[model samples]
Structure formats: C-alpha cells, structure tokens
Target: MTPPPLAADTHPPTELARVEFTALTGERVERIAPISQGWGHLSWTVRTTSGRYLIKTGIRRPQQADLYRQVAAQQIAAGSGVATPIVVAVGTPDGPLQRPCYVQTWIEGADAASVLPRLGPQENDRYASALGRQVAAVHRIPGPRFAEDCAATTTYPTWQAACLSRIGRLAASIEEKAVLPPAVLYAVADRLKTLTDQLGNGIVPRLTHRDLYLPNTLITGEPAGAALLDWEAAAFYDPVWDFVKLGMWVFEPHPALRAPFMAGYTEFEPLPDGFHERLTLYQGIEYLAAFPYFGSAWPDERMLASFRTLLSGWMDAHGLVGARP
Candidate 1:
C-alpha cells in the first residue's frame, strides 16, 4: 500500500527522503518532522523504528556535485576525529522537489549559539577550546584549489586576486541593493580594494568551514562538547577567512570565548602571520555584506544596528571612511 505523502508544508519532499531512508537502512520510518528551514535548504528530523536521522535538502534543484562536496568535507572532518554527522545517503531527489539531498545520523544537541550564553565560564571556555581544535583540524586538510566553494573547479592565481574578486562581488551586491549611500559605498569599495591589495601572495588554500559560528555548532554530551553542523559552505580558501568569520560571528559577540578558542587553535597551528590586518579587512567586508546578506529576515534588530555602528567605527579606525582608492 502506498504510504500517505509527507506533509505538504515540508518542502523538498520529505516523503522521498523517507522512502530513500527506508530503502537504504531497511528500517521502517515511524515519524518525520521539519526541524529547520532557511537559506534555500530544508531539514527534517526523521525517526525510524530504531533510530533518528537528519535529512537536509535544498528548496531548489541542487548541484549534485556540490552535495557530494558537502558530504565529502563532512566525512573528511569526521575521519579526522571531529564530531560531524555521518552521511548515509546523498543524491538528487527523484520527485517534484528536484533538489539534491542527503541523509545523515541525527545528533541530539543544542545549538551552541543558544547554549553558550547560558553556560558557566569554565564550560563555555571548554566548548570554545574544542571548537578551535576542530577548526584547526579542518584547516590541516588541503583543498582542490583556491576557490570559495568546495565544489568550485575554478582557481585563482593569487590569494589577493581571490579576495578582491569576492570583495568586488560583495560591493556589487550591496550597491545593487542600495543599502548604503553612493558616496559611502564608493569609499568603502576603495577601502576594501586597498585592504585586499595588502594581502600578499603564495597562500595555500585549505579546507575551511566557511560558515563556522556558534549557531552552526551543536553542543552535545554530558559536559557539553561541540560539534560542527552544516557543511554546505565548506570551501578551499585562506584559513584567515575562517578566522574572520569566527571573529565576527563568535568572538566579537561572546568576547570570553576568544582567548580559549585561540589558545586551542594554536595547540595544532599557530595563528597565521598578519592575522590582525587580514582580520580587519575581512571584518569590514562582512559587516557591509550583512546588510544585504541578512536582509529583512535578520532575527536581531539590535545586532543589525550594532553592525552599522561597528562598520562606522571600523571605517574611522582605519582612517578611510572617505579616503581615495
């Protein structure tokens, strides 16, 4: 007998995922429910008779290769003893959903973003340290080439070139959105270009979880260990980019995590030279990008306002708010 289709509201055809899961594991699916949905992806927590699993799929047709890359990165991290989810199956959905999807072992944990604020100082530091070590391990693995996406085959000759290209794209995006005034936008573009030029060449691209942040980290275990989630944004790029992301998304917000995290990272690898300068440039780019990147859906108005204030102070600190290119 044909099973009743999964809920219509569960986008990307959770029914297909259920069928695929059953076929793969020979386990009867008992229940499935959407757990998270955003950024063009929908995730469902599926409970089988024996266990639970996570099925993540995009709302639109996904690049099959990209899905593979995501799984590959996750597997690599897992192999390195990092606590990433184990992949069970991945492929294009053979249904109306059309998007690529993957099923993996479900982890019972709270998002570090929500959990960190409530933790005691010692516990927070421990999780932060664990996260740092995990990040360092990921960086130890080399990538295919210098590109933003793990699945990207394109290569850039120099780190500066790759960085400038990315900055250009961000500038163009913000300009298109008209998030900032024309004068301010032009100056900011020039400042970014100047900063990008300062980044020298011969940097090797390393595997990086480009979206590492408290929200993307899952804290599990009795004492609460940290595990990375969401490998969709993994990439081959300067490791400094990951540091910049962590600085903005983690350290800046939760200042206490900074010292322990940095300490843990240095356990495997010392902080890269010129790290602070690179961080400043990258932070400026990210702060500006946040406007269009988060859009109206930004959950925290206070945070958004903080970014504006931060951006203004950043430009002033660099003494380039209206400086020429």
Candidate 2:
C-alpha cells in the first residue's frame, strides 16, 4: 500500500502541550515523548504523577469537535468489553488552548504490525485469533435506529441506502478531481451502480471500526490478546465491510494469517453466503472512494502511480477491464 503523506505538525510545542496537559489533568508532566507511528495526529506519551497517559492533538484546526466525538466512541467501544484505552480528560474546543485535545491512559504493547512478523507460526495464529474475537465483540454493539448523516443533522432509512448515497457523492468528487483515468472512472461508476442494485436492503447494521487494520491494534503476551486503537473512524455501517478491509489489509496478503482470523470471527458469527462476491464489490468501492482523499493528501507521481496500479489490479481480478457505464 502507498504510504499516506505525513501531515505537518500543527500541534503546539511540547512545553505548550505540557502546560495544557498539566492544566487539564491537574498533574505535572514528568516526561513527554512523541509517538512516531501515526500519520494524521500529533501524539505524545506523557508520564505524570497520576499515571502514564497519551496526549493527542489534531494535525489541523477544526478537529476539536471530532476529537471529542472520537473519545465518546472509544468509551462506547470500551463499554462493549473491547480492550480499548480509557479517556481520562478532554479539552473543550473553544477553550483558551484553542486546539481540541484529549488524554487517555497509555496502553503497553507494540503495534501488531511490528510484532506479528517476529512470532512463530503458532504464536502468529494465536495473535490473529485474539484480534478477530475482539473485532467480533465490537461488531456486536447495536447500531442506532436511524442512519447518521455526515453533517450530523439528518437520517436515512437504512445503512445500505446511506452508504450508497455517500458513495455516489464520493464518485462525483473523484470525477471532478480527474485523478483517475477515464477508463478507470467509467469502470468504477459501473461497479458502484451494480453494487447498489445487488446489495439491496434490510441488512442489520452494526458498529464498525472502519480503520481496524493491523497497525491500529496492539499485541501483548501472557494474556495473549489485542487492544484496538484509534476509534476516530468508528461508525455505524455494514459489519461485512470491516471483514473485507481486514481481509484485504491484514490477512489475504499474508497467507499464514488468514485462517486464524477467520477461525476466530466464525466462532462468534458465521460468514454469510456470497461472501467473496460482496467482499470484491466492497473492495472496489473502497479503492475508488479512497482515491480522492489520498490523491489530495499525496499528489506526487509515485503515489498516484501506486493507486493506479492497485485499481488496475483490482479491475483485472474482478473481470472489470473495459467495463464502462
């Protein structure tokens, strides 16, 4: 996968972050160190008299409300028995600090991506299974009766309808950008319409951690479990979409990892019929939908080429070559 461009650090300086941290938590910061793995947020591991905590700020303005919402989502996930970090305190958007921020208890494990490759076959499977079960647990949370609008003011009758509507908007955005070639854009439009027709309605909606790839999970020993991080992208949507993302980003590329995750998830909920076809449809939509955002973030030739290559491969695999609206 092409790496996302590193967002410039718009966060306050460490001393300033420390001052705000002290003001919010009422404890002096003993140490502050940056966490380098993330791309979108500026975060630091902060040690204080109370405990070790994570201090995170958005890389851009207008992120305060979103940060607050993310904290709420993490609380919901934790309440559902998922091993997520607890939110300690949150700074208001209009406060003197101006930047919205939050403090959460620090988790103590390396990301799964870093640890998975070092483990033996048995250990890897064990980790994957644990991760799968946690994902299933999150999916068990009941979704809202009404679909959530992007602007947070309206609702749709069904999750599928809401998703199709969103994809339609995304299709228009991508076409306007013209980042993708005409052939690819035409193929994407054809697939989107077909998926909308075939997917239909009345599927039960569930809480989906839309960004639950390998790096977003932390692996630990002894207890042998995974702690999911980054609840910012959590939403109410089709649970199958999460499985498709996991298969594409986590399991499929690494053959040895596939069976264990499936074994764990199937233990909780069985895969529905026509799973592969649905998975293909969702994957295609994801690639196309992602193009606009990723293209805007990283506009260099190499990144665009990488995206084109991925889209071309998906088209070939799905027999979508020469497919046009």
Candidate 3:
C-alpha cells in the first residue's frame, strides 16, 4: 500500500529533496526545514530574487493525485478574506520534480501555538479571537457540498478503519512498553467504542479542520494576521470535532481554550449546546484512547507531561479515573 506524501509536494519543500531552480519563478531556494508533523504533501520555503514563498508539491501517487487540494484551499482562502498563502504558480512537477507543485506567498513569523501558552491572558484572548475569525472565514467558504473531497484531502474510508485498527495497536503498545496497567488498556478500549458510536448520529456536518490545534495557526498581533494552513486532513464532518480537538490539545477540557475559539468562530454568539459533553466525547474517544498506541514511541517527559495534563483535564471535566492505586 502506498503511504501518503508530504503535503504541498513542491521544489524546495521542507520534506522532499530540494529541486534545481527553474525559469518559471525567480525565487531561489535558500533554506529548508522538513515540515515535521505535517502529512500528505511536502512543503518548503523558498527565498527568491523577489521574496519568500511557501511551496508545496504532491507526493507518491494516490487516487487523489495532483494538486486539487492546493487549488481548493487557495480558492477558498481568497474568496473568504482568510490570510492564506497567496497562490503563486501551480504546475506539474517540472521534469526532475515528478510530483505536482504549488507556490504561495510565505507567511513570516511563527506558528501561534509557539507563543500561546506564554501570552498574557489578554494576548491569549486576542489571539483566540483572531483565530476564531480566521477559521470562520474559511468555514464560511461556499462549497456546493461541504464535505471534503477524500482523495484531495488525504482522507478515505480507510481512515475510519485505521482508527478501529488502532485499538489493538494501542493495547500492544501498552503491553510492550508497560506504560500503564492492563486494566487501563481495557478501560480505554471500552471508552473508545462508546465514543466512536457518536460519530454520525445526527449527520449535522460542517466543514472541519480536523486538525486545527494551535500549531497549525499562524498569527501576528498588530493587525493580528492569522492563517490556517495545511488542509490535508480537513473534511466536512462534525464542526465540533475541530473545536473539541482544540480544547483537548490546549488544556484538555479547559474552558479557557474553548471560550475564544468559539467566540471568534461566530459573528454573533452561538450556543454550543452540550459543548462540554461533546468536548469530552472527542478527547476521551480520540486522544485518550489513542494515547497508548504511542506509548512506545513518545515515552519521554514531553509525552509524560502531555498525558499528565490530559489526565488532569479529563478528571476535572468528568470525574473519571481508572485504577488509581
């Protein structure tokens, strides 16, 4: 089976080997950093004779092969006033570049996640507002059908199956690494099954980032420029999935995270009915249940601290703890 390519597969991409400069664009590839933690297509930054641009190219072939995702994102961002990387050039991988490529204006500065935790409460709130408004802009993009084009966005029916298959992998990782007790594994499995059951009960779908945590958001304070990049896993699904994932990652049911995210998301106040329960459902089902699967790989303090935070947040949100000796 072919694995997905790094998203935005392009010359000078962060992951793929940088390619030779071509005449089509004057930009020169200056520095490159493998966009780790990103998927589907590889992306990189290029410093040209003119200016910097974020270039992405396609990867090893998949059914949704080519550059539709880039086009769709650029179109959506442009129409909605979202601060997206400006679409520059879209083309087939130039000869040596077997994959398709796309060029967009580079976003300077850092990802918002980097500075979020350190900011003062006011900064945090302001940034959250920026993010909310930015996300709302993208979500507002009009698509005849709101659901993601699976092939275009690196998702498929296989994705749901992969999550299910993760159950055994989670248990094996726990047993292999001995991170937690056997009972804990069983408990996680039980909770996951219940959570997955809620996936499509009402079919009230909305465009979702699917992975809209802080890391993916780029921010500036003056005008507060914010952009949501990397649309590989984005799809039309329960909109709450995005917000809940944000809460889970930021503080694990910490209402602080939800407050601004939800606020900026709407022009007027929108009630997130059953918001807490919905929030808990996603994390308990998604993050907590999947934690054991990574036990073998992410065993250090970073991993430990993250889970400790998760546990604290989970317990605080819903009075549930397992096998605490």
Q: Estimate TM-scores for all models.
A: 0.84, 0.87, 0.63
Q: Write the per-residue lDDT of candidate 1 for residues 97-186, one digit (tens) a residue.
A: 355678899878878877777899998888888888878888888876787667665668677888788878877877787666767777
Clashes of 1: 0
Residue 171 displacement (Å), model 2: 1.5
Top candidate on TM-score is 2
| Candidate 3 per-residue C-alpha lDDT over 1-325 given as tens digits, one digit per residue, 9 for 90 to 100 | 2334443433243324345334336555666555544444556666766777766655533223446654665655666677766776665644344456666777775677676667788777777777788777666553343345423443324323433555555666667777666675566666665655544434343456677777777877456456777665556544566665665565463457567766777763354566555656656545554455445543455666577566545645554576620
User: Which parts of model 3 have CA positions greater than 4 angstroms off?
Assistant: 1-43, 47-51, 57-80, 86-101, 108-110, 114-123, 140-182, 195-201, 221-224, 251-258, 296-301, 308-325
Candidate 2 ranges beyond 4 A from true positions: 1-11, 60-62, 93-97, 146-154, 222-224, 300-303, 321-325
TM-score of 2: 0.87
User: By lDDT, highest first, what's the ranking?
Assistant: 1, 2, 3
Pairs that clash in candidate 1:
none
| Per-residue error (Å), model 3, residue 2 | 7.0
The candidate, 1 or 3, that scores higher on lDDT is 1
User: Least lDDT summed over 10 consecutive residues: which range in candidate 2?
Assistant: 145-154
- Among all windows of 10 consecutive residues in model 1, the one with the lowest summed lDDT is 1-10
